[model samples]
Target: MIHSCPLLRSLTLLLLMAGLTFSCQTRNSSDNTTEQTAALPPAPNFNADSAYAFVARQVAFGPRVPNSAAHVQTGNYLVETLKKYGFTVTEQPFTATTYDGKKLNARNIIGSYNPQASKRIMLASHWDSRPFADADSTQKNSPVPGANDGASGVGVLLEIARVLSQDSTKLSLGVDLVFFDAEDWGNSAVATDAYAGFCLGSQYWAANRHIPNYTAYFGVLLDMVGAKGATFPKEGYSTKNANEVVRNVWTTASQLGYSTYFIDQQGPSITDDHVPVNEIAKFPMIDIIHMQVNNLSQTFFKEWHTTEDDMDTIDPATLKAVGQTLIQVLYNEAQPVI
Candidate 1:
């Protein structure tokens, strides 16, 4: 995904230059309500080593680019892994014609926990690595390893599934972990308003949902979540569309003593997979992505969309922060809102 607005990025820089805090202006008003949401039962431990291993496994498959053997192998591995955790898995296969006119075979993989429950929440991450590392100085056409951009988020969710499997009690709401495919095949030159080819799997799934009239209370999409020294401010689109969910998540992260990573800052708008999930599916969703106003070259992490986004870029500590926060969020939502 790309940072959607240069103006917003500039504004963030100006604010930082002016010595202003990057917090949400309206956060105080809803703090009480969000605080209530974060005060639920404690979540199970999120193992960083296990999550790291999962990330390594995905990277081991090489780049999971569309229509490639590695892509098919990784897809099968994801399905089998989800099934091992007792999730009801479904594969929604489709053909997506990208902006450059490449017809790619893609599938959005879904894993449902507590499928019978009416109340539900969605967690998602793009599973396919970018076909080209355009951001790299050399090897501009080579495939991205996607250790942080793709695999990290999936690894976190997979660990969540494993942790949930070990828990004894039933959750309060159903959970859907969606591994979106064909998300990184678009032309990076015109990524923002004209990013039609990006996030193909989500766009398709939103229009032609696997379940008839399927809906969720809220959703969260994770991207670029395992980079070293990564910071996840509240993304702009999420604040616009799913402020309640953002407030709760940020509050929970702070409560868990991770305020450093999950800051109170408001990040730039990102054109990512969650946009379709919000606009097309008509479900409020938020994006937890790594964006830095401090980065001179790009708003994303240093290795974004580059061949350098390999296993060396993956940070176990960063993974633990995001994974643990997500686990806390889910367990918190497992309790009925008071």
Candidate 2:
């Protein structure tokens, strides 16, 4: 999932479903003629239970605010988990000043697999809990539980990491999982400009990537993807910036029998993490974010920026739809060597 957003997080728009093209070639030998078609690689099964547990574990740590103890603990946990899953992990720590001039100690955690492969794919999600619940009428100063907005995306990616590690399938390309920090400290609700201070982690990463001169074939981002009856439309920016990536991913989801969830509609542009990746890093990325169809502007989840965004808002089915779709996308691109 890759797209751009405001309080909207990392995200995409869509190209037409028919844009994804495949071809088979024929070779005429002296003895016989043969046709070779595209191979269907087996995508590892995405475990909803495991993904759910990962979400729950993050919630138990309380809000992962940039300067909070929970933030530090969760960072350590993420690093250890990726390492356990055989990824070479890297932590990029940097300081950033927020919209209100508050200094944030932020770190972008990155996990790399098959570093030697030049062809690569990137997956990303923000990992910080919002410091304020501005969306709720009450508890305006309370921190959001972030079950969907932050933790849900990370949980799905973590499950993917586990699957990639456990499965014997040898991927034809490299994969990078990036958990961005300080993404939720923006002043969307309190400010006149919606995108004044959002996506700090992505902004930093886009400018200073973990690997110098690093590039990928494409990228996908996930945000607020584990809610009940979650709807994923083609984000406005994604449709325009990386329509091909959107077409391939959305088409894959539909092929996997998830057309109900991944709706083939246009969504509003968001100022999320994927914005910088596309605009600054020059990467073609798509955002697989959950959005409401009725609301054109700020179509985030109802519990977004609210304290009510807790474990109760998370649905295992939604997680399965998103996680499984991502796995399929990866495996579909894989071409094993003889």
C-alpha positional error of residue 300 in candidate 2 after TM-score superposition, expressed in Å:
1.9
Native-structure RMSD, model 1? 11.2
| Segments in model 2 whose C-alpha atoms lie over 4 Å from true places | 1-39, 189-194, 295-298, 336-338
For candidate 2, the 10 contiguous residues with the lowest summed lDDT are: 30-39
**lDDT (tens digit, per residue) of candidate 1 on 94-132:** 999888778999999999999998999999999999998
Distance (Å) between predicted and true CA of 76, model 2?
0.6
State the local distance difference test value for candidate 2.
0.88
lDDT of 2 at 117: 91
The number of the candidate with the highest lDDT is 1
lDDT (Cα, 0-100) at 168 in candidate 2: 84
Question: For model 1, what is the error of residue 227's alpha carbon versus the real structure, in angstroms, after optimal superposition?
Answer: 0.7
lDDT of each: 0.89, 0.88
Each candidate structure's count of clashing pairs = 0, 24
All models, RMSD in angstroms: 11.2, 13.1
